[model samples]
Target: MEVEIISEESIKPSSPTPHHLRTYNLSLLDYLVGYPYVPIVFYYPNHNDNDNNIFQALQRSLVLKKSLSETLTQFYPLAGTLKGDSIECNDVGANYVLVLVHGRLDGFLHKPDLGLINRFLPLEPSFDQSSVGSRVTNVKVNIFKCGGIAVGLCVSHKILDGAALYTFLKGWANMASKSEEVTYPKIISPLVFPAESLRLRDIFQVSYQTVLKEAALKVAASRNGVQQPTRVEVVSALLWKCTIAASKEAYGIQKTTWLNHSLNLRKKLPTKTSKDLIGNMMRVSSAVCKDNDETTLHSLVNKVHDSIVKVNDEFVNEAQGDEWYVAMHKLLQQMGEIGSVGPTEYYIFTSWCKMGFNDIDFGWGKPSWVSGLIGKGFKGFFNLVTLMDTKCGEGVEAWVTLDEEELKILQCNPELLAYASVDPSPLSNDHVI
Candidate 1:
């Protein structure tokens, strides 16, 4: 799978950002996440008439580039540079690269090499504070030989999260397709959760992946006398269980493990304008298993559920009040104590499920597949798992990255294998969008 860089340019906003909106303040959550970026690619199969495929591809490329320019005007922050804890909205523009893949989309999707997929992204997802250059977003357009296209984006976590990324993409698609519906990005996250001065520590975040089929998910969800577990809940519990086992095997003893699930704060927050509020409006819910505790699926499920429940309306409201810094301090303090007691591991879980990544249709059709990377070739993250919806929209795909030894043991786990298909092809779903 060779990719030729056809062209490179910066896609600036179609219009200039007003002088009043020049400096976009970073929320406390945004500052806390440090300098990572979201790396995702959306694969769209070529559906134009074969006779006009060549011409169609050219025209489609024009539409995408043009629409992206217009979309950036609305998402002005994306076209700016990251300055300290804020975004210098000088309309610097996002780095847009046009690449031509020397292979067909199907060929790549057939095997879908995780390592090779990073080639489609313009920048690596992991970065330290000093490494976070001015650019807030990077876009790469990969045109396959078959006239198919894969749009990959690496947006700074300092400005966007999974939900915000979806909003940005949908807006771009709406412009490209010339759809009647319009997307208005409400940059109210900063106002809602203002940035604060607090001591921050870097927490490593990264991933490796596995796919859990619908049938297996069903069994896993209900296997433990637990009545109705959500897909995310069951999958998180299962993976946590596997990680615990792998750790015990590797270390010859049980180690207390902690699971931190990222919870979207949009709905939980009491803000009336949160529906369209963008940025990293998310927080992690902590669930732990002591070495002596029962680590059954049922127990894990309950723990996962309970941990998530703690991040409800009340908790969010409290965090947003005058004691916000105090709340943050306590949260970080708890995280700092991860391995203090003894041998322990902490895994971070974030779900892109139900975020409508598959439904982002630029014009031709919804993407046949959507993919992302945790932190490839980057050491800032480990023991991270990101869950996304499969193309069929029925199964969950879990991308996890763990230690090499632990990963080897996890790959051979019979229980996990029974439920997950390991690294399967994206076309296995056989459905687009």
Candidate 2:
């Protein structure tokens, strides 16, 4: 799909400020670092209709404002190590926040495009390697010739998670709509810091034997020695089935869900609890699969639901964690007793990209489109999925990636084919939302 930029604005600028040393809670650090900076892509399909005017309206609604350098402040306090020796400053503020108004577009354009999207993914920011502040530089607005608009948000994971960013965007939209004054978002930073008594070693335990054994056993059990797909593969299959079913049921055509998912290495360890953590500790993992058969939306959703649920089983989590930790530990030991070993497999997938962006509205209304790019780093599997509120109907929209072989299998299933043809209205309330 081709994108046209009707207008653009920067919410922050790239700059440094006097350092401010502030200790962050451990729980906040865990949540921040445990989550990856997965880009959110929102697509508003069929931009030609009156419904599509939301995009244009947003452009007119939002009041663009620039802040003083001192106004640039870090929302999440940095970890002590990252804040070492200097008071970190949040002098980085965007020049302006673009308000996008309008919401009519084909849903397909919002789906992930592995080829182009991967190139724009941000580099993982480091606490020690650089200053602790917003790393994101710009935002792009592209209007497609196909009557779709795609809004690309490039934000530093260090500055915000999916939830925070969405809140900001939604607030912006509400303001533009003249609904309410922008409300200050609740800062959950303090909640994620590490407990005073817990040391890094205690909180980030890295043991491999336990995780590996569990993974082996779970693989054996998934299909009675049929060789279970990797975590990426399982989620890819589930999403592909779910989206295809939803599309078929809503549009009467067998389609596919081709998107990516993000993973966080810090949280995947058997010892880690996602409750609270800081920093942008994450990686991207993706898989793609498609189905061509007719299928009810419920059936497709069930398939995706089941696949995701299965991979999170305790045995699966332990096995995946143990195997990953052991392998990394060995690699690190050989590298000369490294002080720290970052988890190689950052959890299996990211739901924030899929679920986090939908609620963002900057006064003009919900975004016509929201999406993110794949970041640079270790290479393996990556997927980015987003939960979209469809204009055609109501229900969650899932995008995923899969290989050709898997895609073929998904398309040929008769059960999936039938499931794709059902209506989504009756089943809309059944979804978790």
Question: Which candidate tops TM-score?
Answer: 1
Give all candidates' CA lDDT scores.
0.82, 0.36
If scored against the real structure, what TM-score would every candidate get? 0.94, 0.46
How would you encode candidate 2's per-residue C-alpha lDDT over 1-433 as one tens digit per residue? 3323344443442244334433333332233243323355554454345654555534432332222111133332221123322223343344233333233235443333345543222232223333444333334444443334455554444445555555455544554445545434443433322223221110000000000112232233345222544433333344444435444554555543323233433344343434223233333222223344333333333344444444333422332244534533443354322213321211133444233455554333455433343322323223223333343223333333323333344445454333232123221233222
Candidate with maximal lDDT: 1
Q: What is the RMSD of candidate 2?
A: 12.8
Tell me how far the alpha carbon of residue 356 in candidate 2 is from the true structure, in angstroms, after superposition. 7.7
Model 2 TM-score, all chains together? 0.46
Stretches of model 2 off by over 4 angstroms after superposition: 1-10, 13-36, 44-88, 95-134, 143-149, 195-359, 368-393, 420-433
**Whole-structure CA lDDT of model 1:** 0.82
Give the Cα error of residue 401 in candidate 2, in Å. 2.8
* Tens digits of lDDT, candidate 1, 386-427: 899987778888888888888889999988887787878888
